[model samples]
Structures are given as structure tokens and as C-alpha cells.
Target: MNNNIVYKNVNLKEFTSCKTGGPAKYFIQIDNVDDLINTLDSAKKEGINIFVLGGGSNVLINDNGFEGLVIKIQNKKLKVVPTMDDYFEIAVGAGWNLNNLIMELTQQSISCLEDLYGIPGTVGGSIRGNCGVTNFEIKDVVSKVYNLDWLRFNDYNFEIKTYNQNECGFGYRESIFKRKANIIWETNLVGKKCNETIIKEKIKNIMDKRLKNQPYEFPNSGSTFKNVNLNEFDSNIWNSENLLVVDCEHRQQVPAGWLIDQCGLKGFSINGVKISEKHANFIVNFDNAKSLDTFNLISFIKQKVFEKFGVHLELEIQLIGF
Candidate 1:
């Protein structure tokens, strides 16, 4: 049998969208189910820490590199199987590009992913992160999740299963995957069929709105903070009579953009990282902007916002290494 494991130091910057990260001790690509099992088993045997890297879009890695192995999910395919009564179950590999998958699904009349067009990263990343705007996360439609337990891919002994959103423990940008750190091999998305042209048009509208607001050209995580809740967050905001009625009605989910912009942080900068002059929520790398640059910018925003508004900003981007 051909050996699929790679033992080398991988420059994570090349794989990450931010264009800056240190290096990984070991990098492995799992192209199929068999490959995934093999890679995981080898890592376990060697007593190496495992980090599954999916499109590398919504994270900033430290400049010092990861101490464990980085497994890049390279298996890409979307299989459409016909179900009863004009329905279809789409099996999407975790390695698939999220945008491309959405676009293709829209073209083929898939209804669920239309509003999720502009989100970056991969199928598994989105699933694991539970990414979405407000209440429209990807886990909303997940039917059954397939997982490989203990890196055993060859046989069914190491397999595990979870069904639906409740089992997934999906919350605001969180799931069991964050704690368990297991593999999401594929997803069975059961969605209704719609007119292909209409689906495409809707996706285009939502996607265009996203592009117009966010800076797509620059390398940065989409949003820096998860909005704090009104009831569960810091208790100080409750007695304030000046809180926006809209914010109050929504309970805790305030838009990070509004809060950041309100703090006059749109053009804020530190070193080469600046809160994208276009969007307050985005912190971009201006040429020589390294991981440290973004880190400092985030720090400035957090500090300033807390001092000015008394609300701490919880980051949405996954910060690794440092």
C-alpha cells in the first residue's frame, strides 16, 4: 500500500487566507475515508496532537507555529442522491469550498444554502463553526453527521453518528466539534427543491449585499466578534435607558458591525493591520501585516470598546498558536 502521511514542517500561511501563520510540525491530507482513518491512526500512535484544517479562512495562526499535526481535509465531491417525492439528499464532503458548493447547489436548485453564499472557508469548517447570520446557521438543515472515532477509518468499529441540530449542540458559533475536535467526514443536507433560476437570483442578491459591505479583496476573517447577549451578557446594560429598542428586543444578539462602528473604530490601525476602512467588522493585513499586526488591532478594538462602552467584544475568528 502507498504511504499517505507527510512528515514535514508546513508553512500554514500558504493554506490560510490571512496569508500569515507560522508553521505546523506535521501536515497530512485525507483525500478519502480510508486516507482520513490512516492519517488519524498514525497521529494517535505517534502521540501527536491533531488539528483538522479546513479552507483556513476564519482563523489567524500564531507566528510560532502549531505544536501538533495539521490535517488538511482535501476530499472534495458533492454527490446528489434522489430521494422520495421529488426530494434529494446532498452529501457534501467536508473539504469542499463553501462558496463553490453554495453556488453549484443554487445552480442545481438547492434551497437551503442560498443565503450562505458569501461565507468563506469549507463545508466542515462552516459545519463545525456553525457559521451564520443571526438565526440562519448551517446546522439548521443538517440531517445526520458522520464521524470517525479514534482515527479508525478502515472498519465501522470506530464510527459514530449524530442526528439533527439538537444532537449537534449548535449555539452561536459553537458546537461539540469545538470541544471534541473530531472529524466531520461529510454532511447529509436534506433540503427542498426550487426553481433553479429563482434560487440563483436569490443567492446572487444575498451574495452581492455581502460583497458590497465586506472587503472581499483583503485577507481577513469575516467578523471579529460574536455579539454579546443582553440578558446573559454583562448585567450593566439592563438599567441603561438609552439602549436601542431594536437591540433590546433582540435579547442578546447585537450586530458587531454596529457596535464597532459606533466606537469610531472603522479606520483604526495598529502596525499593518487596520479595521478595513470599508467595514468596521473587518481587520485586514496591509501589505506587511503579520499575525501580530492583526492581534494588536484586535486588542486595540477590544480595549477601546470596553473602555468607551463597557461591553467586551468576543471574537468570532479562531485564534491559534498565540
Candidate 2:
């Protein structure tokens, strides 16, 4: 229960990847599970709302700032264990950077995460969104999730639990963690051993493809909208846009970027935010953008895409403080 971890009136823009948030009224860095529990307890006692921040890669904070406590998880611990057969279990702290973890696993000849190279955010944050690329997702290799069930916080309990893959409720960019407001502590990932040369080549290809298709040159929170599932909508309307649809593990999905691109909204801007010319799915903070600018652009994109194709686009990035 260390009490020296709090800070007041901290600028949140410095903590997010988009770099456009206002100051947090109260901020705290949690280094361990015990400290996080203590901090949450204190905030609860004060009736202050709580926001847990991870790598800050997939969230947009509002310009007005959060009124309550902002907890930044910083517990970084990594472990690797070789079990029977060709299986290797990797345990990563929730606060561990996801790209770093992938690199470390790839260097060790682990094949499970080689295709996910260059994805941003912390392991915990990635799991919250079930982050992935193409056909692979964090849920594929995640065997177990260690977390503090926040629902029990009111009962004076801080006991942590380990949930198996099924209990995690993993679906297209979703998990029970998002619904339960649970605090992810760490995750157990299992991967098969592969030739280091093959793993490196695959990683290289994935990284190159990402660089080519994504707008990484500007400050952005990655994809702004989720891909539309084909089964959910009238398939005949998408017949002409077949080139824009890609096969995902879940189903045939229409890329949100393609929808925005088809609406002629690429490079569209309002204030300082612009839908990236390089990738329509990204709304870049190219000119010192405000959260409101991004929000308005999002609404505009949704309206235009709907008007053009009669399909509504849902946001993938999480909004904070708004």
C-alpha cells in the first residue's frame, strides 16, 4: 500500500499515442498488483471514478480531462518456461509493451506471435481489444489471463484469478475484460518452437506489409472503425466492392478503410484531424488535433459512408473522458 505513487494535474497528452488529451485531475503509476489494489481502494473510498491506462495506443482522451483517478499500470515482468513437447509458455506482464514481447518471443524462435509484429499497445491493452492483425489475434496464443475481477472490489476483496481461454470470452476484438472492467495483471501465451530463420522471414513480411498499408507517419490511434461482417448486411450491395472485402478468420469482412475510401473521404479534414490519405481507416492528428476534431471527423465519416453504402461503421478505438 505504498502512498507515494500519486500525482495531481498531470497532462495526459504526454501519456497517449495520439498526444491530444487534457490534464488528468489525479494520476497514479501502479508498479504491482498490491499497489494497484490499494490505489483502487483509495479512489473508491473517495467516490472517484477510475481509468486504467496501458500503452495508450488505442484510446483517445477528451480535451476536458478526466475528473477522477487515472492509473497507469507499469508492472513489467516476463518469464519463459519450456514444457513437455515443443510447447513453450511465455508469461508477460500486462504492462509489458506488446511489440517488445513479440520481438522477444520471435528471437526465442516462438512462432505464435511472429505474424503480429509491429502492433502497438501493452499486452493488457491489446487483450482488452483482442488486438490482432489479418488472421491472427492475441486471443489465439493466449492460454490464460491473470486479472483482478473488479466486480468484487466492493466486497473488500483483491483476490486475483486466472481465466482460461474460454472464460476470457474472446471474440472479434472483444473479451470479457472489456465488459467486466477487470484489471489484467498478466497473460500466459503458448507457442510452438519454429525455425528461427522462418520466424524472422515471416516477421519481416508482416512488418513490411503493415508499413505499406498503415499510416504510421502521423500520430493516430490505429484503425478508427471495425470491419463490417458480411453476414450482418445485405450481401448483394457488396458484390461490386468485392475487391475491398478480405477474408478474416471470423468471416468475410469489409475493410472500414475501403468504405471510407469509397466515400471519397480519404484526406478529409476538419480542424486539425484528417482521415489519413495513406489509409482511410486512420484519422491522423496531423495538425495538433483536438479530441473533438477527431470525434467530428468520425461522425462525418460514418455519415458519408452510410449515405454512400447504407452501412454504418462502428468505432474500434476506445474514447476516454468524453
- Give the top-scoring candidate (TM-score): 2
Q: Pick the candidate with the highest lDDT.
A: 2
In candidate 2, list every pair of residues with a backbone clash: none
Off-target runs (Cα >4 Å) in candidate 1 are: 1-7, 149-157, 232-241, 244-251
TM-score of 2: 0.94
Candidate 2: regions farther than 4 A off: 1-4, 239-243
lDDT of 2 by residue, 187-240 (tens): 899989888889888878878888898888888899999998876566667575
lDDT of 1: 0.77
Q: Given candidate 1, what's the lDDT at residue 147?
A: 60
Ten-residue segment with the worst summed lDDT in candidate 2?
A: 234-243
Counting clashing residue pairs in each candidate, in order, gives 2, 0
Model 1, span 72-96: residue lDDT tens: 8876868888788767888888888
